[model samples]
Target chain A: MDLRAKLALLADAAKYDASCASSGTEKRDSRAGGLGSTEGMGICHAYAPDGRCVSLLKVLLTNSCIFDCAYCINRKSSDVRRARFTVEELVRLTLAFYRRNYIEGLFLSSGIIRSSDYTMEQLIRVARTLREEHGFLGYIHLKTIPDAAPELLAEAGRWADRLSINIELPQVRSLKELAPEKDLAGIHGAMGNLSGHIAEAKEARRTPTRAAPPRFAPAGQSTQMIVGADDSDDRHILGTSDALYKKFGLKRVYYSGFSPIPDASAKLPPAPPPLLREHRLYQADWLLRFYGFETQEILAGGEGGMLDLELDPKLAWALKHRALFPLDLNRASREALLRIPGLGARNVDRILAARRYSSVRLADLARLRVPLKKVSPFILAPDHRPARGQLDSAGLRRQLLAPSAFAQAAKPRQLALDV
Target chain B: MYSVTLESPADFAGWREAARGLLGAGIPPEAVSWHSPAEPAGLFAGPPPPDVPAQSAIPPVPRDFLEMAERAARHSDPERFALLYGLLWDARRAPGLLRTPTEPRMARLEAMARAVKRDAHKMHAFLRFREIDTPEGPRSVAWFEPEHHIVEAEAGFFQRRFAALRWSILTPRRCAHWDGAEIRFAEGARRADAPADDAAEDLWRTYFASIFNPARLKPDAMRAEMPKKYWKNLPEARIIPALMQGASGRVRAMLGQEPASQPQPPGPRRRRKD
Candidate 1:
């Protein structure tokens, strides 16, 4: 097949790699008059599991790798069809697709070949040519080789908007087991280098000087951790993410559940990790990062090593601590409102805003756009009051467990209709 | 990063002159960029503000701000040049120079007004309305919300969408209505008894449930992205309950079904067995 045909095959294949965000990067446009501009937010197209890469031209430098990671489809031992793009050919294709408005920018990843250093250099050259030669300011997220030289990694930061070095697995043992050829020390070194560079650049920008700061990676760096490939549970995964963020100063820690590769190694499992487990990890991760919940606090509630499969992490947390419910909606803090399972951040804002004009009751909540049914039981509102003292601790847990608890306990046949 | 500050001017003659002065004083022009209170409205900006008082009327003086895209070009990065040059530039401001208004200040004034009015704060301050059901009998109600009184802005959006419905949006600020008549604003938040929109609400609930992606539940992430402030006026805000599928077994099962509207959760765990 010609380049287009090869791109169709390879680009589509590459979409399986989630983590296609193009935010946090500077803008770039094609002087060649390519259709879209990256100087704006690069097209942040997410590949939603059933296989669609609709937004970006997510492609690989080459699918040919010299290392064999048991979980990776592109590992040297795998039998998948492979294609490689020359630096020039990749640029031409990017321009062609861009002119047609087919994509926003390039999300380029490659399997290591020739050598880690050689592969890293080739990737750097592609980004440099796109940026300097063409002034192509679209979002360029280059997958920096953790094993690449520090100078090359710094150069990668200069041209690309965001750089990601996949941690691959959570545990050091797993990294040694699944992909022994991959060096954990090398990975840590690259992450440290990026953190230093981004911090230095940002600090320079802060000085009250008229001169611009040296451009490093302005958008910052993030890393990915493959969930479920190892024996680690949700608690373990969340703990891992927290440590990485604290230590490496990452922008994000993407969780890519270990999807079942076509030809698996003897060391690999036959099935994909439970999709819901990955979903739960993301929730737990969010709660830890944004909700002010510590990792151990959330971990304490999970009876199984995993998060609650039926309910959200927050709700499950609430159910465990039923005494905290029946909070006063009229005077609850934003932090307190956030604790309620159904009352998201938005609901809290509405409640606070409306209460300023009127003493909020259950009815007022409905008016302010707060989900009273979800929040009402947990909170005491004016119009529709909660039967706070009536319920025993166990019953309260059941109520926090599900919004339809009373009706469900009263009538189990209504499950389909109730939902 | 001083993000979201609107920049005015595009290296106008005055800006170039300022650059020369700064350069003479040893400051590299590339060290820092300036952003004034310009409207985010692009080259094809919208119609000028119809309201706001005369303070903005004389129209802003025209020379645009200069952009600094490089830092290395400066000697010692910025220190060697800035210490001497920064002082000279600061002292160099012309005391009596009001200068002639070039392009017209109407655009800048309008831009600042719109920024304040449409900003997230205004969204919280404004927005008044009553609930109404849809033709399909779902309870959905809308209110008249504004950055300022743009009858056309609110009316244009509602006429086609809620033409046949009865909804009242009352603002401590301004009022809007579709009393089954021409879309127009009244004086304040309408009476609560303007007739309920039960069907619209039901439809909204269904629409909310239908469109909500189960795989997209990140309370902290969602909260950070769509701050807790603006939920007061939006019908979809109530749907946040429905967004938390894991909290309910039935909802969790529903999410597992991979509703055609969204995708099947493909996180490593959900991949199908061959």
Candidate 2:
């Protein structure tokens, strides 16, 4: 099939992997036609180091695979239609769409066919073609195959602006049980190899003779873990990710909710987890990574390893620790401001910047993009303060979680997380 | 349906007041964002307009002015932007924040954008050139583009940066392509020069496919975020039909529960994260 045909088939299949991002280079449309255009906000997203969001041309090289990982829809055992694309096909699609001012660059992954080395090599070739043959300075993200050879893995590094290896199932035992062919040790080994290359490349960048060291994927490496495919608790999942980040210099660890495919293992159950569970996990993840709250504190927000689906993790945390309430907005450190559910890191920065020139009031905080309705109970501003004794942790939890009289029995209760 | 009026000439202040009037009528901000790049060529003058007085006490001007000047250089429309700079950022201070939505904050942002455009045009005009030889032949290059004609004004962003490289900004609307030898214009009407309606538009098709996140596809919400007007210019816009056609299947998938008939081991009931 032609590049376009392959792209249509592969991209359609790949859309199921929702790690949408398209940023890295600041390259704008200076020439007559090139793909990198920053002029329009269009639809580019980037993940803040704390995992906000980033834009990239995220897609798969192919959906064809050799192994039947039960949790994966595209696994070999599944009946889902599959397709693969050549390196040139992806290069053409990425450059063409980019030139027409469509996206920032490519995010290519694949299901292993033939062998891990062969698949990884094909993915690497796409990046090389865009960079070397086309002088395509746009962002290139190649998903790393954890089982690929270490040397071929080195080539993956030389081309991609970012590399990611999905951790599949969270628990090692769950991974072993669900994906008989997959190995956690191999995944860790790939991550370790990427780290060594990136470090070496950084050092090489300093030497004039080292051909400029090609900036070795400045967006950095990231991984994704499929949640709910096993009984691994929230604590265990976060712990796995935390270890990945600290052990290897990973930029992100995405959570792909396990969407069970057909002909799946009998060991796997039928219904998917609540979408709210994934949302709660993201909120909890944000708390641990950015808000200085440990995984222990995040896990504390609910009844068990599960988080409260109704309230956001931060708000749930604040309810559990009422002593932290009425946090002085003026005196609170950056870390404290981040802990507030409604105030994002960007808003925190804006608040800090605004406060430098003038004293901030409750209204001013709102104008600065603070979610006043949510943060009100937790923070004290120059003009307004929450009634300190109004609600204890248990009292507030009851009030927050109570069924709103406005809701009909048939209608789903709208939670603060929804808004 | 609303759009910014640039067909007729108006200074930055005059434009701001008009936008505020429209904004008060409860219109979305997107309704009036697009306008002419900056002060139009017809508006150029020998001196500052009567309204402009002197520089303000504000510590520093926004970088937008410098950016505008660079764009103007590429277009080579210096006089228009010079007069715009003289009119918009004179010694006097800008108005304090609008007391209420009565003045429309988003409108003010656009008007300020217009002011920057005017000043940038002026800088684009005054940019000097240097020459160089390449396999392609001699070319003039200068590295400078700012919203204001800071090139002519006191800013000196030019001499410092362009001292080594031979490149020039072929400003936004107008051409400022520099061959190391001298700067030239790739002038004409703005044309994207797209394929002839059906000239093998596969890359765009694939690009549209790759960028569309099935997980986050919100039809009405997406249409709201990216208006229908801009779709014709994007490749992924074509996928909207297929997307809508598949919307029911998608909704089913998003809302569907785990398959029940399959037998499984007795462990923690594994819910699919779908």
Query: Residue B177 CA error for candidate 2 (Å)?
Result: 9.9
What is the TM-score of each predicted model, taking all chains together? 0.59, 0.68
What would the per-residue lDDT of candidate 2 be over residues B131-191, giving only the tens digit for each residue? 4456766444333334332232322222222222334343333444433344444432232
C-alpha displacement of A282 in model 1, angstroms?
Answer: 1.3
Q: After superposition, how far is residue A48 of candidate 2 from its true place, in Å?
A: 22
**How many clashes show up per model?**
57, 65
In terms of lDDT, model 2 sits at: 0.55
**Model 2 residue B97 distance off true place after TM-score fit, in angstroms:** 11
What class would a CAPRI assessor give candidate 1's docking?
Answer: incorrect
| Candidate 2 accuracy as TM-score | 0.68
lDDT of 2 at B30: 34
Cα miss at A16, model 1 (Å)? 3.9
Model 1: per-residue Cα lDDT at residue B153: 40
